[model samples]
Target: MTTNTLDADLALRLAVEDLYADYVHTIDDDRLEEWPGLFTEDGIYRVTTRENHDNGLPLAMVYCDGRGMMADRISALRTANIYEPHVYCHVLSAVRILGASGGVIRARSNFSVLRTMQEGDTSLFAVGRTFDTLVEEGGRLRFRERLAVLDSRRVDTLLVIPV
Candidate 1:
C-alpha cells in the first residue's frame, strides 16, 4: 500500500478503537445517558443469545431501534425500573474490522462484563460477542447498529443495563 493509504487505514483503525473505549467508559462510569450519543440518530441496538442468533430467531432480550428508543430506555432505567443497585466493568478485546463499504465499517469484538453490587460483591455477569456496523458522523465514529450476542442464554439477574 502507498504511504498515504497505510496512514488512512491506521487512522480508521484508531478511530474505531476509540469509539469502543468511549462506549465502555460511558457504561462503566454510570454515564448511561451518554450511551445513546455513541450511536447514529437512527441506530439500532439488540442483545440476544448466541443460540437465538444462530437459529435465526428474531427474539431479543433488549432491543432499541433508534436513538430515541435508547434514550427512553435510559430514562426508564433511571425512573421506572426497579432492581438491585450495581455497576458494570466491561472488558473488551481488540476490534476485528471485517470490512468497510458505502461509508460503513463492519466490526466485531468479544466482551465480558463483571457486575458489582452495592454490597461490594462482584461476579461475572455476561460474556458476548458484539457485531457492529459503524459510520462516521460529524467527524466522529458512531454505531449504526450494535448486535450483542451473548454466549449463554441465562442471566442471573435483571438485565436493565446495556451490554
Candidate 2:
C-alpha cells in the first residue's frame, strides 16, 4: 500500500476504536440517554444469536430502529422495567475494518461484557461480535447499523441493558 493509503487506514482504525471506547463507556456508565446519540437519526441496532444472524433469521432478542426507538428503550428501562441495577465492564478486541462503500465504513469487533451486580457479584454477561456500518454525520462518526451477534442463544437472566 502507498503511504497515503496506510495513513488513511491507520486513521480509520483509530477513529473506529475511539467510537467503540466511547460507546462502551456510555453503556457501562449507565448513561443510557447518550447511547442513541452514538447512532444516526435512522440507525438500526439489533442483538441476536450468531446462528440466527448466520441463517438470515429476522428474529431479534432486542431490536430498535431509529434514534427515537432507542430513546424509548432507555425510557422503558428507567420507568417501566424493574430489575437490579448493574454495571458492565466491556472488553473489546479484534476490531477489523471490512471495507468502505458509498461513504459508509463496515467493521467488526469482538466483545465480552462482564456484569457486576449492586451486591458486587460479577459474571460473564455476554460474549458477542458487533458488526457495524458507520458514517460521518454532523462531523462525528455515527453508527448507521449495529448488529450484536451473541455466541450463545440462551441468556441466563434479564437483559435490561444493551450489550
Candidate 3:
C-alpha cells in the first residue's frame, strides 16, 4: 500500500473507533436520546444470533429500519418497557476494516457488554460481532447499517435495551 493509502486507512479506522466509543457511552450513560444521531436518517440496525444471520434468516432480537424507529425504541424503553434498570459497560476490540468504496466504509468489531444492576450485581450480558457500514456525513462517520450478531442464542432475561 502507498503511504497516503496507509494514512487514510488509519484515519478511517480511528474515526470508526471513535464512533463505536461514542455509541457505547451514549447507551451506557443512559443518554438514549443521542443514540439515533449516531446513524443516518435512513439507517438500519439489527441484532440477531450469528446462526440466524449466517443462515439469512429475517429474525432479529431488535430491528430498526430508520432513525425514527430507533428514536421510538428509546422512547419506549424509557416510558413503556418495564424491566430491571441496569447499565452496560461495553468493551470493543479487534476492529477490522473490511473495505471502503464510494465514500462508504465496511468494518467489523468484537464487543462484550457487562451489565450491572441497581443492586450491584454484574454479569457478562452479551458478546457479539458488530458488522457496520459507515458513511461520512458532515465530516462525521454515521452508521448506514449496523448488525450485531450474538454468539449465544439464549439471553438471560428480557433484552429491553439494544445490544
lDDT of each residue in 40-148, candidate 3, tens digit only: 9999999999889889898998999999999999999999989988989999899888999999999999999999998999999999999999999988999999999
Per-residue lDDT of 14 in model 2: 91
In candidate 3, stretches whose alpha carbon ends up further than 4 angstroms from where it belongs are none
Clashing pairs in 2: none
TM-score for each predicted model, relative to the true structure: 0.98, 0.96, 0.96
lDDT of each: 0.96, 0.93, 0.92
Superposing every Cα of model 1 onto the true structure, what RMSD results? Answer: 0.7
Candidate 1 lDDT score relative to the true structure: 0.96
lDDT of 1 by residue, 99-147 (tens): 9988999999999999999999999999999999999999999999999
Predicted structure with the largest lDDT when compared to the true one:
1
Q: Compare candidates 1 and 3 on TM-score and give the better one.
A: 1
Q: TM-score for model 2?
A: 0.96
- Give the poorly placed runs of model 1, Cα more than 4 Å off: none
